[model samples]
Target: MDMVISNLQQQRAVTEQLRREAAIKRMLVSQAVADIVKFINEHEQDDCLLHGFTSQRINPFREKSSCTLI
Candidate 1:
């Protein structure tokens, strides 16, 4: 009976340890996701600023008109 109780206690301790590790991992993942979101927002703003330098017009292929003043 004593051996059985000892085994049960050890199993309980191991289970508690695993639970704590899992909680810590979950917390770290949550923090990482938040950081990624912040970084993506900043990157998107940077791209918006860069878009101003890009082309803003598309020329038509056929365009020839002239006015003569005689």
Candidate 2:
């Protein structure tokens, strides 16, 4: 009876430890995804700013046009 009780306690402890490790892994994964999204947003904002600054000097391509296209 004492041996059975000891085995049950060990199993319970192991299960709890696994659950805590899984929770920590999930939190790390979520944080990594959030960081990636933030980096992408910052890169997009930089691209938009660059395009805005260069747009005035850029020329439009036209195959055929009666009037000047800008």
Model 2 poorest ten-residue lDDT run: 56-65
TM-scores of the candidates are: 0.36, 0.36
Error of 2 at 67 (Å): 92
Supply candidate 2's per-residue lDDT for 24. Answer: 77
lDDT of 2 by residue, 1-70 (tens): 9999999999999999999988873458789999999998889866645466545444343244478679
User: Residue-wise lDDT of candidate 1 within 1-70, one digit each (tens)?
Assistant: 9999999999999999999988873458789999999998889855635454334343333355689899
Predicted structure 2, TM vs. truth = 0.36
lDDT score for candidate 2 against the true structure: 0.75
Best by lDDT: 2
Q: Residue 16 in candidate 1 has what lDDT?
A: 100
Candidate 1, residue 48: lDDT:
38
| Predictions in order: lDDT | 0.74, 0.75
